[model samples]
Target: MTKQLILCDCLGSQSVDRAALSHATGLPCSRVHTALCTRAIDSAAKAISDGDVVIACAQEAPRFEELAAELERPAPLCVDIRDRAGWSEDGDSTAKMSALIAEARLAPPPVKTIDVTSDGLCLIIGPARVALPAAERLADTLAVTVLLLDGTEDLPLSRRYEVITGDLKRAQGSFGNFTLRLDRLRIVEPGGRGDFSLTAPRDGAETLCDLILDLSGTTPLFPAPHKRDGYLRADPGSATAIAEAVFEIAQMVGTFEKTLFLTLEEHLCAHSRAGQVGCTRCLDICPTGAFSPAGDSVTVDPMICAGCGACSSLCPSGAIKYDAPPVAHLIARIRTLSEAFRAAGGSAPHLLVHDEDHGAEMIALSARFGRGLPADVIPLAVPALAGFGHAEILAALASGFAGVDILPSPRSERDPITYEIALAAAMGAGDRVALLDVDTPDAMSDALYAQTSSAADSATDIAPVLLMGDRRQVARLAARTLMPQQDTPVPLPVGAPYGAVLVDGDKCTLCLSCVSLCPSGALLDNPDLPQLRFQEDACLQCGICATICPESAITLEPRFDPTDAAMSQRVLNEEEPFCCIECGAAFGVKSTVEKIVATLAGKHAMFSGNGTERLIQMCDDCRIKAQYHKDNNPMASRERPRVRTTEDYFGQRRDH
Candidate 1:
């Protein structure tokens, strides 16, 4: 059923062309309502009761949701057309509005989540003055334990919470399951004591808690401490900070839904092969220590992962994928927006990719106060802006967008974004993709408006490509579309995922060690001959094959080969096969066998014997048989001893 779009003019603040939007979006857009949340709320209620409606007002979404709940119906999908498009200072936002509506109509992927239950056990770490006060605030709501840094303070008579003196050695885990180790630990002995006296100090004392309130006024226990859910930290000297931390800590009890941000395909991981490290991009860039090496592949602790998505963006093999909404869904949104914009007579549309929190707020603020976004600019809200890697950027460009400008929030990781932009530029995007590091709404608007024209003239004419593959495949398709005229291979940055393997034939020796250890099957050996074959497109540029190569002949060249030759296997090195001396069957490489003969035939004592040098040139079966029959062979049988045991024993007994 076609969804009904409830359009609102927000009391005549912004213009809305119902007829034009309906024509462009192919949806039943109602007449513009001046007051959808006030006098005309009955219409919204009727639409909700009827089912399958899209409310075009995001500002009043809560009221509409409440109405739906009251009417015993599902909450309608909300799209903020006002803040994103209608209120734009640049005139004629009809095309932008259509694109926004069309993109919002697409079904969102279901979010995967795990239920985490916190039993309200809180650990407070700081001096007695800070820890005791914070513990008192949370004692009623949570089971509190105060770990006092200074034991010199006078003790309180009332035991509202357990008090202990210790130095926190280490802290691990996340929100609902924190594991802590303390050294020089001492527990307060309350019985028959005028003043609290601590027991004997001990080391390596371990405890578990559901949450931690750090008032130690020192370094945080976890990296990226703000990203940790149940861990709260505050300065001991600041009473306001302590109060805020205590209040936040009090509410963090009971069951909560945690998003499983990533999914791992173990077979596709290029982390390691045969104990040799292939790729450590995820481990290197992960802001939180969520990834750990597990045998050949890496394992992610979803509980500890803050979902910065640096790992997913840098992952070469799509082994670790951001799952809040999969990469395909994001691509689909980009395609839909681009196609819809073009259909509505929009040319040279630019994508403004930003995170949900910072980006959304900026757009809303710009529309309400400052000059709104330009008509040609379409805003795309992603869960993690860092996850918008080079492939996604290329995909937007190839799907008819003239350029892509990423707006990263203060919390977003900058290194990965910079690297992805650099990579995308190397693969034909050039200056078409960029990072907009604006602080405020006015700055964001100014930066976007400054780029009045499309990044490239060719971008407007390039036909869009269907993005239906993994990251690499999508990237290749986009690259081909972007650089249709260029026949030469594009040179990529040093650590690019796409590349070719260079082998020095003089040193390779047809050893085939690299082929065996290649995780992506990019390197292979020919069964018929001593050959090293490689498919350039299949190579991950992981450097595992080079690391495992015994001859140290293998090296990597980072470049994107767009031609068909990249898809097919080509010989890197080949040698004529050596024939067996006895059976004439091919076995090893001719040059390798001759080299062995030259090195050891006359000098080695074992090979100096008669017919022994010939053994080196023969096949395995022939060599084994020859060795069994050779003089003084270890396999030669000895003469058996006479067995007259019974007769000899009887003769000895008679003599006795």
Candidate 2:
């Protein structure tokens, strides 16, 4: 059965035409309710009993879920159409509401996850005054150990938690599995006759714990501290911060689901080839230090990865991809929103992309206090805003969205987001794509509303293309669709994933060094002839070929080539083959052979004779035979010595 859409007008505050939505979405709609959370809740319960119903109100989702549990039913999918579209001040929000509903109907793929278990082993590192009190609160909940930074003078003995003093040498891992190394360590020897005494200081003490509460008041133990689970940091002087950290620490003591945010294809990674570094975008962009060089490609520690998704966006080869909801599903949602909006008589729709935390809250606040989103504006809430890369922005524009506006929160890493926007803009998007860095909800609303001009009229008619294959493939398809009339390749900014490899013909010697080191098979050598061939579409702009070139003949040109010529191999440099002197068989390059002869013909003693110098132009088999038969051949031997040992001695003795 088709899922029913149960919507509310919020006490007649917003208009929702049931007929228009039903026609636009082709889903059965319930009669508009004034108060779905109170008086009309029974109707919601009846609808919930049917299963596969979409609740149009997100604010009362908890109450509805609680009611569903009471009635022994699964929670219905809730989409906030009110704040997103219905409550907007723009007249006739039916088209926007329909688009939001259509997008919600897409069932996102199940998120991949791993179970992380914390057995409540906590390590507290701070001064005694701060660590002891925090450890005391967590003693009942967790197996606590306090590492005192200052001297343990006037300290009372305690059995509830072990106390120690050490300099934390290194801390690694995350959540349930943290490995720590401490130097100059001393453990409390409580069995002494006098007050508590510690053992002699030792170096390189190793320990393991499930959690770490760092109140050292110096520096964070890990980079991107806020993203590290089970590792909490707070200022030692701030009582409130310490208290909050303790309370949070006490609750993290069980198996939790950690989403596997990225999927890696090692073979596809262009990180390195033959020890030559190619693409390091992921390694450079990962803020949490989750990625490290394993061999040629990088490996990600699932336990430590914070899932900012900057790596996935920056990865040129599609080796690492965001997988919480998958890139395919995200594109499907974008396409659905664009298609449904136009189907419902909407024109020039702009997409507002934001994360669930900051952007959703901002939209909610705007709906309640100020004018909500415009009728032509649609909101897309992503798990991580940074995951939406240039491909997605282009997809939205190609799918009929007049423009795309990304709203990043204050906490989001702006560098990756800005780069992606710049990349998208460089690919013919121009001013159609923007990053809104407004702080307040009103400011966001004002900025969105102030935009009067729509994207170029050509964008409206461009039909959405099917987004198949990997990130690079999808990007190419979208770029092609965006500018179908343009026949030439689009010039992209430097460091773009798409590009061509340029070779200097004069400098190249057909050594085939670049072809051997190319990770993407973008560079190849002709078996029959000495030639360097390149496929521009396959070139990742990784610079491995350029770096591996012995002659320094290869260079990279970053651009997007949508023509068919990019798909096929094109010869970059070629030369006539040198024939064997004896058999006329093709061997090496003619130019290389002539150069070798010119340098070694008579100048070198080994090739002083005309016959010996001819060996330089011979094939492998011909060269070997000619060298063996030469008059002064190194393999030639004198007449063999006869057996004159025993017989000659006997004859001499007889003569005597």
Candidate 3:
């Protein structure tokens, strides 16, 4: 690694942890400066010029960047150790500050962008009397199409836009590619009633429109309609709201950058296995209708995804990864911050996670007005609350954070942050719901200051460890490593990713239905024998196996296994293989085959005869051959009576 200049800021509040910062960042004592903006700017110029700078202050980043550019120096990598670690009244956060800096050194991978080009093909969905005016405003910039839901429509003012009437059945997709399913469509004609005329209604219509200006305020066409891009709906009666919508809708005609938020590993998706539906967590939680069952797998439309990351959080398989930055980068930050704070001898550190918007505002206000955060508190700002899930939460605990607090977006009230906080607590991570859901900065400070006992906050020399592998792997590892230190894993809450599958061997018969349905390969089958295998660590406990098991022999037991056995593969059920009577090849389970024969023999017509009983013991090819031979044997054939009928009839007639 290149030798870098390290600058720590007291952030105009507290004393700097110069020694601890230097020790953690591996920079020499002389090179690391406190209040880098005030003192070290002139001295650090040479290092900045060489592109070897690490600024430990996020608040002054823009100023430093400008200064670096003016000095023809490379832009320095920046991290916030102030609000995150040092802003707290807890004196010198040398260890925590150092960790933040070290974490910042590891660069995040770049994200790919998807471009959505809109040609201004707008659809106005409202009563024509209301929708026509909104369409007129956008007619200049967009190729406007009016879809009237009612029969009475206003006459067109201009010939530029097309007007048609229909009821919108469903509307989906996003900017530059809106798809609408509409029916009961009729066109406007010159001769009918007071308003105008409508052609006879016809059903089943689909149109490809780039934008939708909704005024038919009946029901939204997409989930979380506000989150659906390029589709604007407002109160039909509010003139001001409608005007604002028109302005916003007009600007949506140009090309825009749509974040490729989700990285999909289609194969890892447990949505369906062998054409049987397995996991629908992503589908159930997606605020925007981005995921749809396509064949055996689900397809996610990046264009339609609102980036809530609920899908990623609830995803049993790590098939859906929110890559605003990859999980590794986030985990790296968590590890570094936790380890650094501990290294500097900080005790019972609280990881305060917030986003860049209101959360940031509260931190700033709290610092200036209310009691600044306690020294043990460290702040981490993410793009959104959804970006980090239980994996990151438990990773914080495993890394030795005493507690976790999150400041979520306002819409979080509708359901986002609180739900996530509950999940974290269920996994044995200290619940910071009060701090996260607090209404004011002062209340936030009060909440932080009020904290007393954090069961896992004790300082232990757990070296910073990066979480690896998939979501379940990380979550399992965190629970094993941290929950033991805080508490022990018992029965996790419902929907938890841990637990074992209980199988009744008497009823199982080694059918392997559970094995086939398991998406995580938790339940595996031995090809050479009739056996079902399970790895507790891999079992997401989605109940896919239990749901699909035909014999009703499998049941889910949701419990946390902290021992090595959780990961080791074990036989859930095994039975003797039923060998084919003809080729002697193992095919079915002996018990299952016998059970089937016992149930069917003398009851079903096909299995009644003793000769036919041999068919069950033979392989498919042998059964076909045996049946062919038996039907064609001369001894087995009934004597033919066909040609005697005509001769016998003529002889009988002559005798009479």
Candidate 4:
């Protein structure tokens, strides 16, 4: 890796210990005061020319970026050390700055872009007055079609596109190809409109459109209506909103680049097994209806996926990963921040994770209005709020951080952030991470300040223990490392990703229905014998096994097991195989065979005959052979009719 040059803006804003930053990064750094961005550009040019550098100023990022581009240097790592670090009252803690700089150097993985092409086949479904006008505005750019919700309203002044009356029954599909189903569709005659005479009336008419200008003044076609791509909705009651919708829809005609946020590993999913449905964790929690069950697997529509990563966080198996930055990259930031802070002669690290979009604004607001974030509280910006979970939180605690918190923007429904806090609370480290609803800068400053004050209450401080693997693997390692901190993990709340698998052994028949349906391989069945085994650590608590068990023999006990035994395989149930009476071959479950024999022997007509009852216990081959011989036995058969056929015909002719 190319070493980074840390340039602090001590001359412009506040002083940062250059020596501490150098020690933490183990790289040469140039601390410039007045001429970093302007006249005294020698240090910056020299550093950038030397290979690469880390600039500690976000305010002048554009200027530095331009300079780097002019010099043909790889994008220099630009971090907001001003609002994020220098402006803090926590004093010149260069170690935390170094940590942030280190994280910025680890470039985000290159994203694969998917092109969503739109042909501008726009549909305006709303009132005649607004829908007609909106369609007319977009007609030049888009192939517009207007559907008036109520022809009862006055007829349009003029119709540029085809004006029709219809009720929008349902709508689905993504950009460039949206499927709309309309009912009682009819064309309106524009000329001499006396009550708007309808020409052709059609039922259940369907159309394909690239964009939907929903001036309908009704419920949106998709959930999270605004988030749906290519569907621009505005109230028909508002003229301004309608104009905005029309303006926005016009520009959506050509191909656009959308990042493929979540990567789906279908084989790793526990969504279904052998036609039985198992985990629907991702489905239940996905804010957008991006995920839907596709037979044994689930499909994630990247077009609709807003990249919140709630599905990825809730997924028990690491089937879905947040590729925007990945969990590993974010988790590694926690380690870097804590380790670097301690090494740089700083104490009591209170890590604060914030979403770049929501938290950035709030951080800026707090710095401008209220007291800036406490120096002890390290701000770690992530791709999405839902990207981090219990594993990351546990890792923070294990990484010697005294406290941790996440600033969640206002949400109607609680996200995985709160759920993660609950999971860690079970481990007696709930105080380590909190979901702070910080709207104003003052609220954010106060929250971090309070957290830092309480950080001393936590007696068991942890050191950074690095572990790398999939979500489940890292979660287990973090759990095991943090287990000694608590007496026992508390029972988790509803919808928690971690829990124990419960079996109703009395109802279980060694059928292995739940075992076969388990996607995480947590439930195992021995083919050599009739038995079921469970590995708790591997279980995502997706409840797919329980949901799939036909006999209702499986149930999930939502609890945190921070012990080694949780991951160990243990036999849940076992039964002996039934041996055939004649061949001595093991075929079926002994209990099942015995139960069948008890239910049918001597009671049914077929089983009541001599030696017939024994047939039930006989192997399939033995039974077939016995039946064959019985039918072929000459002594037990009646006289043959073939020999008398000619004689019988002559005797009948004589009698007649």
The candidate 2 region of ten consecutive residues with least summed lDDT is 451-460
The RMSD of every model to the true structure, in order and in angstroms, is 3.8, 4.3, 7.9, 6.0
**Model 4 Cα lDDT, one tens digit per residue, 1-656:** 56666565645657766777777878876764555777666677777778867777777778788888888887677787767777776667676777677666665667778998998888888877677777777878888888877645666655567777777788997778799887888777766735556767778888888888888777778987766888888988988998888888889988898888888989988787667676888888887799999888899988888888777877778899988877777777777777777777777777787877778888877765667878777888877777677777777877777767877766423657677677776654655678787668887898788778766644345545886887767766776676664546568787666777777778888877777677778889887777889887777787777777778888887777777778688998888888888888876688877888899998998888677788878778987777767754545567566666888999999999
Please give the CA lDDT of all the candidate structures: 0.91, 0.89, 0.74, 0.76
| All candidates: TM-score | 0.95, 0.94, 0.79, 0.86
Better of 3 and 4 by lDDT: 4
Each candidate: how many clashes? 0, 0, 4, 4
Per-residue lDDT, model 3, residue 194, is: 58
lDDT by residue (1-656, candidate 1, tens digit) is 67898899999988888898899988888889999999999988989998789999888889989999999898999988899998888988999999998899898999999999999999998988888878877889999998888855676666889988888889999999999999989888888947877899999999999999999988999989999889999989999999999998899888999999999999999989889998999999888899999989999999999888889988998899998899999999999999999898889999999999989999999989999999999999999888999999999999999989999999899999999999999887988888999889999998888884435666678888899888888999898888887787889999999999999998989888888888899999999899999999999999998899889999999999888889999999999999998999998999999999999887899899686898899999999999998887998898788887988999999999
Q: Judge candidate 4 at residue 235 and give its lDDT.
A: 82
The best-first sequence of candidates by TM-score reads: 1, 2, 4, 3
Instruction: Tell me the lDDT of model 2 at 34.
Output: 95
For model 1 the local lDDT of residue 372 reads 90
**Ten residues in sequence with the least summed lDDT for candidate 3:** 452-461
Winner on TM-score between 2 and 3 is 2
Order of models, best lDDT first? 1, 2, 4, 3
